[model samples]
Target: MQKPALDIHEIPSPGKWFLLSIQHLFAMFGSTVLVPFLTGLDPAIALITSGIGTLTFILITKGQMPSYLGSSFAFIAPIIAAKASGGPGAAMMGAFLAGLVYSIVAIIIKRLGSGWIMKLLPSVVVGPVIMVIGLGLAATAVNMAMNDADGKYSLTNFSVALVTLAITITFSIFGRGFFSIIPVLLGIIGGYAFAYTQGLVDFQKVIDAKWFAVPDFTIPFLTYTPGISWTIILLMVPVAVVTISEHIGHQIVLGNVINRDLFQKPGLHRSLLGDGVATMLASLLGGPPSVTYGENIGVLAITRAYSVYLFVGSAVMAIVFGFVGKISALISTIPTPVMGGVSILLFGIIASSGLRTMIDDKIDFGEKRNLVIASVILVLGIGGAVIHIGQSFQVEGMALSAIIGVLLNLVLPEAKKGE
Candidate 1:
């Protein structure tokens, strides 16, 4: 069968470009800012990182594909882990290094070929790992929405939370295509509208907030170290591996959409470097680490418009918004339940992506080695097991699970001849 011709030249007219850009912006808006909001980082900083990251990605890709880079959900668990162990700063440091990990992987792919990187993190491993990243946080989302910070569940908050979550889930499952992607946004609007009706929203801050102000940027204080926990760093490093693989997938999708060989021409290495630079820059500015956003991929898929300059426009818009304190405050007023509703779906989709990866790769479940690897990874990662080397250094949870799985796969003597 002949391959379907790629739609590479469907450029939008000037009027359409504005509408499409608005669509792309709305597509990524909710989840993009939620990362920092959840982690207690500045939402404006997230905006800046996302905008700046998108611009950097365009530069690296030589303005070939139209996509927006945003804050990644993958780093959410690690940021929480780091914050629990050390503080936001320590997690930011580790995540900043995670960006470098992407650069290193890019170099490896460039030197050894993408196939080598693929073999290193096959579907059998990545699938379960991604699932763990999502499912692991299931309860946390619920707790945050319904319960207080101290873990005590509140009847009032829980009720609103459930309603918001139901609305988001319903929209995602039964809504149309574009609606599916923006369920989070819609949920937030719905929840916010309800909250406003009930007089729960405090517009005082928004009124007090200036129309334009600079984002409060801060440097990571190295002195506030969480006592140098090697375990935490080690655990986070493995997650970076999965994200690198995801990065490759994002690039391929972009290339397919734009009808260009991005990995070969501007090269995956440069794109990865762009991500690394953006991430490091974000950390320095008190923002969460950055990654290539899948949300924007949906935008490209729908619009079929490929122009790096448009993303440049988006980046400029983000920077302008970053300086607007009132805007940030308004975004903050989006109730916790609203965010929870959207997160429930977003996190689940992340898990499903991992499953899709395994199925797409045709992973052999009958193989003993594969089964052992998959089973052990899921149990260790989600079961909340911890491994401590000493008082100061401890590897537990996903980090420990990932390391152990890798080791077992590498040295288990070929699974005893298929059991």
Candidate 2:
């Protein structure tokens, strides 16, 4: 098997570090900015918070785990819902609570082992929930890709979206090495260029932007605070379940890549605590919730540059970039069609990953117990089943489904042997 070019502790030369960190920056940039854009948050704040989040994570983990925290896609819909219900303040409130959920789970895992959590969630529960998270946004992707700002279908916009998607898929399947991993970035660039040719991009934003600007930071209750809405909390906090599982899964994958049991050495609790802290920090600062970016992990595996210092450089660069007015302005100018095109692939991939999880775990649909759990989750999630609670708020969609799945898994009996 191939090994990383540089080991975790090995420090590269100044020049190499700069170049390698740039690679990680671009690898993370596309998806990181996309989340903020979709959720009506400022991309610049996302960058700043992402950088700060990573630094905090590294510090808390004692630099044993090499992970870059960025805006998490899982929270896109939740953030939007929270914002719509009560405004950005309520959204951040939910986000903060979501991070708290992570911290709480980290504490639980620290006290107890991971065995009980795994038993509570198993593939049957997790797989469909993951699918719902993705498929839930299918119409949103299409509307963005095909519709104009007026929400009318535009053939031009549709064409641009499809072209972007095509470029992304082509790169994903056939591009070589580093080119393959950065397909999202490449696709966005390609689509943006095409959209420019069609007069779809507005250059005024970039031209008018200041050279240096501080990212707008919105703290809950500082500017605007809404009344407590359990709906927002229920909407946002439950997605933590998916992301925490994602973090643990990535830890296992990273350990496998480096031929070391990270859970044993650095300890799963420490890494999880680091992630939780980073997320809480991000939410407090008015950025979207952060997660361990798989894009950076892919970069580490491909380049074999596992040094923790590299991420430090990347984080610093990210923060600096956040202060550059032009970068954020340019990122904003990227057309909805361009994003929609890539989002089509991304959202689908999210759902497909659910299938992959089930397959990897060999979840048997033939088993009635497993079948019922998955069936309920997929319907409740995708069908947008909402349960009203009193007049103030209610549980709906993914959160409701997730809660039901966990309960069903716990309540249902185990499958018989060779029934």
Which prediction has the highest TM-score against the true structure? 2
- The TM-score obtained by model 1 is 0.90
lDDT tens readout by residue for model 1, 1-419 = 22322233344467765665666777778888889878888899899888888887777766655668888787787888788877766777787778778878767777877777666666777788888878887777877677744668776666666677777778778978678767777878877777576555788889888888877675655434433457557756667866776787888888876667987877888888888878878877778878787877766666555655556667878877888888898997876766776677777888788789889989878877888988998888889988776676777666777677767766765645536
Clashes of each: 2, 2
Please, what are the lDDT tens digits per residue for candidate 2 over residues 274-340? Answer: 8888888888878999889888888888888899899999999999999999999999999999999
Overall lDDT per candidate, in order of appearance? 0.75, 0.89
Q: Note the residue pairs that clash in candidate 2.
A: 4-304, 5-304
Q: At residue 43, give the lDDT of candidate 2.
A: 94
RMSD of each: 3.1, 1.2
